[model samples]
Target chain A: MSVDARIARGGVLVLWAIFFGVLWETGASARYLGSRTQWIVPFGTVVLALAALVYAYGYLRARRGGPALTLREASGLFALLVPLAAVLLVPHAALGSFAASRKGNGLHFLSAGQSAPSKPSDASFLDIRMAEGDTAFAAQAGIKPGLRVHLLGFVSGSSDVPRGTVEIARFYIACCVADAQPVGVPVDAGRTFAKDTWLDVTGSLERRGRRFVVKGERIVAAKEPSQPYLSFRT
Target chain B: MERAGVAAPTVPSFLRLRRAWETGVVSETVFGRLLGGFVLLVVVASALRLGHGPAAQTFLLVFTSIVIEALPFILVGALASAAIAVFLPERALDSLARLPLALQIPGAALSGVAFPVCECGSVPVARRLIARGVHPGAGIAFMLSSPVLNPIVLASTWVAYGGHARGAEMVAGRASLGLVAACAAGLAIGRRTRASDLLRARPGERAEAHDHEQGDRATAFSTHLVSDFLFMGKFIVLGAGLSALVQASVPESALSTLGGAPVMSSLALMLVAFVLSLCSEADAFIAASFTSFSSGAQLAFLVFGPIADLKLSVLYGATFRRWFLLRLLAVTVPLIVIGTLIFEAVT
Candidate 1:
């Protein structure tokens, strides 16, 4: 209703534009948005920045006109600060083992590798199929029980499996963290690792009841992948 | 009607100020008091080291992610809405309203195919449409349809279910059922209500269209755009916070106890969709991940989510009256359920 109020609200929009720009430039969007970082972050930044400039131009056109912003309006504008505060105050981390506890560690998540090589030589390929429980594909790939497989994933302390085993899990994010689902396999590594520890696990694949279990023969520390979350696009 | 030469009765200063405050014209002192109280609460909360935990971390991530994900769409909607308000000819709007109701509702529902915005963007546009004298039912139909019938959403649905045995069926069912639900809900909501009764009044907002001068079109557009974005953006932020809390705290299994039964599974997934408040374009992948649920249940999720969700509920609250959500669900739920069941029976 007032030029000052418009400028104040526009300043908030500018702050958001800055936030999004920082998110895109610093690559922080990947931790929260995953694959969506490529488009959403830049687009949001541009839209917000242009909107802010438009708002500022109007305020400049009528610099001294109208009443001040009302308390309710001011409060509503201030409420936008919540997300900014949350983003700043909360420590940022990738969704990991703790998140899996709620989202579950299941292989039901769809994977990009719907069709793979028969008798695949790559251990990761076998590992993914085993995780997906694609017995037909596994059979085609000659991946039977006791076949040696090397898989890369972070350890998750999933209670779905037996006490002696921890789940080795990877998240497949379709959009953002809200839609992320974990695909994991129960593995017996002899020694326990911290939750979310990246590990290169070379193990013999075994079937126990409905789920696959990995008998780890060689376990080594592995760095988290540059693109930690998996997506069909990549 | 005052008597000639009679002086109007003057009120006491304190009484006038009290009346002003009660009528929503808050004084600087009242505003400062509120600001001070909020600052004190924040300081106390910070001193307590609140929001420090795995759950809080998860909540923060989800909350901010949802905000970041949804804001761009809301901004787009605001810009589109402002354009409609400032640029679209009044005669064009009148022509839209002049159409027969039967044709208008269906036509508006199908128009979503041309407008690719999702639910977040649709809300502001719908509000502007109603304000600009479009048939309220048609505006409502347009709002409900754009998110689901849009090409991007259908393409995503097709791709998400591409690996499934009934991918085509899912896409077809989603499109058809979504259109049906949108029209039904629109007809029901706009049946007896006026636009003023349906939409919330924005405080300090300029009068809708009468004040616009020919030269001030750009200024008016900027005003509407900024106002709509800020208003809608705050609610989305608050809504995202609520959704994040539910997503972080509630175990998925807690709601899935009835995931086995056909009717109950549909209801359960609908509840999940509400709680998750995911974007329509992205929700199909999440629905596809529910391999344990039936196809009908997944369909329920895909259909129910874009129409109503935690985020949309908050936005709706800010936009419409209390009865809006109830009226919406009363019309939409049964249609979606019956549709899904038929989908299940057919396939």
Candidate 2:
């Protein structure tokens, strides 16, 4: 498939522009791409339009018997498109598994004084605290016991806690995933839960040596929150 | 003659043995050579009384992650070059070259802001531009600046350093210095080297060859891209594995000790950057990890890396002639050092 060099180039530019526009609109905030506020979308759109103009030029030139798309030409276009498609797929795959896996493991721990509605009798609460030497929670002791505290975090991979008892775990991100640290407090809730479950728990925090155990609370498993991760205070 | 023929007929086993060695099917030499280095490493590790199990596990993890991640990206770069070879217009670059020198350098640099191509991808493209009549100086400038000046790099830097005043200041300082250095080197190279002296077009081409040369270049570009990708892929993996291994094997105390000495700390971080060959987008995170290093030293790491690191040097050497690359390094390295010194002086 022999394409006019001009046409192939134009097509590539157009495709790239559309991809960049979509990325920008969707809040893809990479430095080279655009900011999170969708400013790049219009810029990308303009590039795409210009590319269309160039493609039109190539098309007109070709119509005068300029050039035909050869097998090699088509393959090259396909090769370029395949990567573009794969790039598009990355966010979907990342969000799907990452969001689901981090569902309920208390990924976010609200500081002390955050209010929570009353909990149902059957469920128990766990007050999660950073381990000693961890600077993430040093400034604020999150959610004290006996106070109605609301917690949002994901369920981490399960761990066996002291014979026949299992505890759900979640990692809190103070920044990017590189700085993520796991926090696990014992949950006396009767049922075992799957890993990465996003949940909201209402309970009282019990302090246990840098960790807060939430006792007697309500657990509500739900969709992962928009902000799946958190950053450490600068 | 009859006696000699009879004797040879009875030696089938010997013939088989000879054939096996010739084909490397049964050569103990080859097997021994393959395992010799690994065995030596094991022996050394055992003698050191280190925890071999954890060390081995860490090495394996690092090796796989580095190699696997780098392979696809290098391939992407190679393919992009091939596409450029096959499809880009012949006179397109000439028209670009007609622009003023001042405009050309920044134009080339800004071109990358939109493309989002990594450092590996820039080498062949730069080569192609030079081949197509873009000034060698401008081409080199683009190659150096594109990796760091692009939107993705800027955004990542902002993201990584946004929270702190020091981080923000560092990014701004590096950007200012890096751009100035790239432009200065480019203009210097542009003025010094004749275009014909710097690059050789594809073989079987005339001084003013047109159609046939284009066709040959297209094929050569594809070949170059594929071969370059495969070759660099191995090294990228090796570098990454070595970095991961070092991270796992050497304790942080080693870095801390070096960190205590100002000059030693700067050189050590620079060495780390060279060894890691990390993508510019990711280097900031690694730099930040060295919380022990002073800001001036960290600035050196960021500046020296994008210009003269291992993988990029290899790419530059491969794409441009060794003489040209050496000259480029001579100019770039000292400039970076001066930039670093100036940055330190000011901040």
Candidate 3:
């Protein structure tokens, strides 16, 4: 490739570096990578920057004449550039009701008959999900029928949810959002809420048939948490 | 002097710059303009459309997350590849080549126990190894097994299943099957083909092939690094988009329909594993979530997923010959089925 084309490719690399740098600077990488942001974002930025520098130095020393840039080369660069640009330009987002419907809730683990960690009343959604599955965890946390708990989540309209109730859901992300599993319990709020509306529900856990439902006492409007998804670690 | 007067012709600076771009001297300006226009267009379009629904919202979230998570590993793979290209001595290559195929393939497959990188980070390193004169079978084995056998992945698998009564069996089944698939595919696919036959040449690579070899070590290292990064990175991004689309549009119930039949369940979960394109380290938790499926089927999900997924398929396409995935599936699918079956029968 020509020196100029090579340099152009380098510019594309710099664009990616800038994206990572921005993610790191704004602490937005945690939203994507969860606990991994501490290392991956900064290290990725450095590798990309160094790679770009290598191209820049090559351009400075290069002679003007070489093969013209090929269509394949241009397409490769754009293929990398366009989607990331689209992501960068779009307003930040999180997994919501649509994702909850498609992915299903994390209740399947309840049937696995496994042990789980004990958590406090203010535990994350993942902890709550796991607690519901493990009898030992529930006992240790003093969780039982008619015990009131505070739950923070968005309203979901998944079809599996019973009528007259909305699934108050948060995603349990393992690694990243791609592996996010919606974990929720049905909240019988006596009224319908718009899907993906963030809500804080103070409710009592009640067993109905084989499943658990939360009987809502106080439901208040809430904002999405700064870290919207609940991760495996705190 | 008056009679001989002639006007001097001059070109405007913009026209001069355009001409320079046309001839490739200032071609970088064109790229800069293309990037700027594309970004502006996307920003405007997203502002209008991103708020319309959750599907687009989910797509953006999953797409960016996958890319962000995978990039660091891709960079690490590129760095390792560059090191192999620039610093791995001729003696090491020769020694690896001299090993017997019977020993080389299994040895390479087992070496994954030490490598902590997942699937995203193994492809380029394998490509570099093949290019640097390692046996094709060995290189393929290393690439295929590294993600599955890596300590982090194994530890995650153990953690995901450890609380259950059959946790040991699941872990053993996954590790055993993963090793079998890797070694089997390596021997089968890499049997008669040389590197020239198996590896796809990157665009512009053929023209400057010798130039890369002959350039200063630093130049060569960086060139290889950038080339591998960009080449593999774009395909990964595209694959992530497709995987995200599948994730958003396809309901989990669609696959759950086939969850009861033992054989069909394994196949369905394998298909799910392919579409999901999850990182190996985290895939076990997802796999363990399918409590209704047989343990064997879940093992297939674990083994087949890390070896081949939508994202890795795209990466493989860029790195290997067109038929490599086909060959890979032919060898691995049967092995996985047989392995899972045996695991079920025994356990």
Residue ranges of candidate 2 with Cα displaced over 4 Å: A1-234, B1-52, B188-191, B194-228, B234-265, B323-329, B344-347
lDDT of 1 by residue, B111-147 (tens): 9998887799999999999988988888899999999
Residue-by-residue lDDT tens digits, candidate 3, A9-121: 77678989998898888888766775633577898889888878876775565544445664457667788876576566554677788888888467544433343335455
Give TM per candidate: 0.88, 0.51, 0.90
Worst 10 residues of 1 chain A by lDDT: A104-113
| Predicted structure with the largest DockQ when compared to the true one | 1
**lDDT string, candidate 3, B1-347, tens digits:** 57776778888999876655444432456655766887788778777775347888887788888888887788889889988988889898899899999999999999988888889989999998999898899999999999999988887777777545576677788888999899999999996889999998766565345445665566666667877788889989988988988988898768666666777888888999999999998888788888778889999999999889999998888899999999999999988988888999999
| Highest lDDT against the true fold, candidate | 1
Q: What tens-digit string does per-residue lDDT give for candidate 2 at B185-300?
A: 78877666766676643322221133225445433443344334433443454455456555455543354346545566666767666655656665664565465577667776
What would the DockQ be for model 2? 0.04
Candidate 1 reaches a DockQ of 0.45
User: How much does each candidate deviate at the interface, measured as C-alpha RMSD after superposition?
Assistant: 3.1, 15.3, 4.3
| Model 3 spans > 4 angstroms off | A1-3, A36-38, A54-68, A108-120, A131-133, A161-163, B1-33, B50-52, B163-165, B206-212
A1-234, model 2: which lDDT tens digit per residue?
323433443555566557656655655423122122124345545644553554455345332332233333333344344324334323321122232222223322332111222332222232233322234432344333454555565555444243333344444332222222344555555566676566677666555554545553788887765444433332
